[model samples]
Target: MKKIVWLSLVVMVLLVLAACGGGESASAPKESDGSASGDTASTETFTYASTSDVVGMSPILTNDSVSANITEHVYEKLFERNIETMEFEPQLAESYEIKDDNTWVIKLKEGIKFHDGTPFNAEAVKYTFDKLRDPATAAPRASLLEPVDTITVIDENTVEIKTKYPYGAFLASLSHSNAAIVSPTADQAQDLMKEPVGTGPFKFVSWTSGDQVELEANEEYWDGAPDLKKVVLKVVPEISTAISMLQAGEIQFIDNLPTEQIKRLEAMENINIEKKEGTPVYYLTFNHSREMNQDPEFREAVAAAIDRDAFVTKLNGLGVRSDSVVGPQVFGYDESADEAGTAYDVEAAKALVEKNGYGDKPIKLLTANRDNFILMAEIVQAQLTEAGFKVEIESMEWATFLDTARGGEYDITFLSWSNVTGDGSELLYPNFHSDNVGSSNRAQYSNPEFDELVVQSRTTIDQEERKAILDKANKVMIEDNAVVVMYHGIVTAAMDKAYSGLELDPNGKWTLKNVTGE
Candidate 1:
């Protein structure tokens, strides 16, 4: 009986070992020689966290940075701006030639197809521009195509776009995601907002509203299949929550990292930090529609009262004090001119306020409820109060704030613009031009001299001539206190060390096509 019991125990232990070994064999890649494969390739899903909800995928409908960031990955423009060179390179279109001052002939790339299997050609380009130009669409970026008079499809692969004028920034505007090519077939979808179809490396898989957006690698991508098989953009409204997710390995990348947590994040092991000087100017814009803000003295008083250096300190020294509307990354930024602008002078501000007859007038400073905006507004509010203005701070959610502010409801609203085109015209034109009042010109600022300078800058093709025109416009706007140009934010992002090949563009774009999960 003892010999039989010992034999049974030995058999049971051997069976357990065999089962464990079989499980390992199933997980490991097989070799023809029946040996260990020794392959080091990884197949991991990359998760990125964003602080704001992506508004939608419609290229022309939204101008928010968050929407642009997401659309960039899912759409391919006729041209793309090189991150290092800051020059326009062909993406959807193979090549382009300026036929004359107003006409540009573009050659489409052959054999490229949208994700919906629609052949991308001259007709597709024409369709995209037509949709954008149509008044019924009411595309928020419709004004971008106002100069484009006609898109003529010369052939299946050739297109000619004629502008109303010789627009110097035409090619640069094409580089924007708002000018991305779309599949005409897919455009028929009743709910195309949730179903974006483009020739990008990633295909939209699912968008769980505000929770997350998921994309999968397009194996048939024209460029090549992406290394990462999947991408998940998890909407984390709070930076602190995103930080916790990053530490817990729930997210691999976190964009727009709040400056307050950088030091703590840097201390963590296997975490990488990427910081690039971006071309976004965070400023306080006045609604010229308001009688009080319409006064130049009042605007100058508000600009002179706030200490930009103190504001930068409150931002945790994460940005450069912006003295001009255009940042250094743009084409026409003038250092001397920027430096010669306004300075913090309490007495000067008070004198200007008295001169403007703004005594005891209730000035409401409206701002988004985001951490940075609220904190910055509070500081500005205190400064304005000390300067003897009846200051009040009003905060609301981002979407609500944008709607209310753009409707000319706010006396002073805090906002920012990411100059994604890398052009001084992009920074100056839409926001200051009188025609752009309902659009990017939230301030309702209109000056014929500034308008003429901007129009001349956009028309002239000479690089130096354009710079001179834009510099003059910047000087005029700054001297008039068009807006209190606060500072340009530094593009700061954090990622897990496991993720590689992430590149930050100076235009404040987060490029993820080359980024891979190790």
Candidate 2:
């Protein structure tokens, strides 16, 4: 709650496993109709549980994965990120041809229409992207599409786009949900946040603020109707409750499987677990804007004090130990980066802290209130204290925490940078480049050399050359202690074997169009 073969990264999001609770009502609210109920299992209905409700349905307006849980089914992108190959594949558009490094021509599929009955054509593509790039719209994902200078329609079935640069990740960026083509007719007809309109396999049914979001089969779906007639995403905040409900046959899926409960879940008679190699790197970043954190020596001392090995061990099977900034699944990863940071040594760390006089200054450790993040923050707090440093931990709600951290108000904060784009440029640009300082680059790190390397990687089309440039740039980040590389997360989920085709990708995203429940 992670690439750019159509990959985009989020500043932080866990894709929490929202599950159903037996203690809570398991049926659709009395006002609803045509939705399957968990009280009785059926082939036509599927229920997936999550810890919280989605932010909204308008794909471009929201960035969190919680909202994606719904958009993944409701929206359709011109190009799709193949969950298996991690490559960009054609979806709404039949095919694409690169005219040059800065230009691509796309041919669209005919006879396709939005859920609202609007024709899916080149005009729709231009309209959707125009809104995405409009400064007034202020779409959260607008920055990712900045590479594209303009999109011009060649015909009803074709469109040509030109980029400001070589833009290596451009095609992959098309696979993102934010790039989903929306119906101009419907978008102007209603508030998309409440009733999103798209050409997906399922239609937006109903959303009860904190309770659930329901979707039903779009019999007119361009791809053909989904096997399941109805799908429900329920909000159940407690993992323990979700586990109990799964055991009772009240819910069919748990998207975010907690590592601490894997053993217990494995013992369940009807449960099946699956793990996807994740492309996210969870790290601790020192705000370079802060005077004290600007000291490379102090940052190195902080890195040396905490033990990443033990930290990952505590993750159980949720992730793997790593010392690199980019995840192994991402294209820019190199084995040499494994030695980029200082190894754990408490005595050496203590000596460095004392020598740097950072021990007297207070280190405010900020983190979201997620269980694993808070646990790690506490663990690091103890380690830093043991190393003779003054550390204090503060936990905040996800939204507030995101704003606070991104605003560069904290000394150091935990950040889970999910490199959705499969390239090294994804891992480097937003997190380290000076241009994104007040936004994605929460670390407030700035180095002209590092910026040049990232820009070079973006303009370089050859994967080998880009990887080399990114690998070199990453060393500069690690050497400067821009952020403490911790571990790579593994996407885990548990489900009743009665359903299939709901497997999550490395980024923990799932497609429910083919999912069936019996």
Candidate 3:
């Protein structure tokens, strides 16, 4: 995230920052009241400080959070989760009916048009999803629709979904950003990332690679025109500089704040700080490819050695320790599963280590060279050494770290996952399912029993039955000790008080919609 396209954009940033008056809030809300066709919501640009540039605009292909955040405004999903109430609501689709355990019928909202002026109908839905289902697309999030059998357009405005199984998380999965409807005209665009067209609150204007993305309000938005005329997501990798920009009012909003600077942000006038209960979990995961790590007892021993409480303390009481990464914000989060999990017991760990006889072997703990991960790794290393284990630490750049960890090149790695879909199936299916061993399931964990339970949880239609199945699946994995969850995080963000209607999700992601800046 420290990457800055500074050499070329230095002059541009200087010019922009100079124009941004010291302590001047978000650009004026509007010239007119945004009620008429000629009316524009905001006259001046409203800038947001983003830690990194968006990876891509193609919703199906984009895997990173920064890109997804940008796309959320530019694209509309068939269903959307209410950030406040945690309920699923229709966006592109008007309504849906469950015909049976394996079938669903949805009626599209009529008269909607994409930014490219293509009529949004059943064909558009079929086009986008067909691309997602296509193997050539190589969509990273394709697993989110693994149970889908077919998407059939029953009529111009109606669509029928047939799942291979009775997938219970289908509705919740549709709410995911990956399920966004793209314009059929998007296929004609030479560059998918640069020329994204969607039916959303904002339309793309420009994307300066690794610098900023500019968007203008969609006055023709089906929901009605947003109160803001323009939005700019600027890449300012340094958190300190971003906070300074917030203080100077050069930027209107910033998220994923450094935990240390949150108090400083809270003290700033006209700056509103928001902390939402979230589902992002940073875990110390064991790579089951290693012989020593494959044993459940040894894995449990390592889990018992680490002090999970110390992690929160190390972060200055800024995080929540979770026995289960399935946080309260997500469905099927079992409180009892947490109660049944292991606790810190140095003596028990030492005994297990001695019994396992792998204490003399060097156990490498790999992590990215980020400050937070390094700090947590040091703590883990110290505690494990104390419990009669030979521990070694390895840190690499973020990109290299991902490549190494995802390929099962490390014994233990510091990693994180956000169950943004608000479903336990999202948590289990990707992270634990043996089928995902080389992909999202970085741990290389393979247990047929655990896999069966997760699949069963998703195939069941009843929520209670699914939850029970998920609870059991979680217990099975917890016993196997594939991962030692450090903590579930809070989504921290800073926005000028002049702006309202900024939304934050439980995955530490913030979105802008209908924001009115005074």
What C-alpha lDDT values do all the predictions have? 0.81, 0.81, 0.81
lDDT tens digits, residue span 99-153, model 1 = 8999999998999988889899899999999998898987766767778888899
Give per-model TM-scores: 0.92, 0.89, 0.86
The residue-by-residue lDDT of candidate 3 on 90-203, one tens digit each, is 889899999988899999999999988889999999898888877788776777778889999999999998999999898888988888999877766656677788999899
Between candidates 1 and 3, which one is better according to TM-score? 1
Give the lowest summed-lDDT range of ten residues in model 1: 33-42
Clashing pairs in 3: 42-229
Sort every candidate by lDDT, greatest first.
1, 2, 3
- Residue pairs clashing in model 1 are none
Model 3 residue 152 distance off true place after TM-score fit, in angstroms? 1.1
Poorest 10 consecutive residues by lDDT, candidate 3? 31-40
When sorted by TM-score, best at the front, the candidate numbers are 1, 2, 3
Which candidate model has the greater TM-score, 1 or 2?
1
Cα shift from native, residue 153, model 3 (Å): 1.5
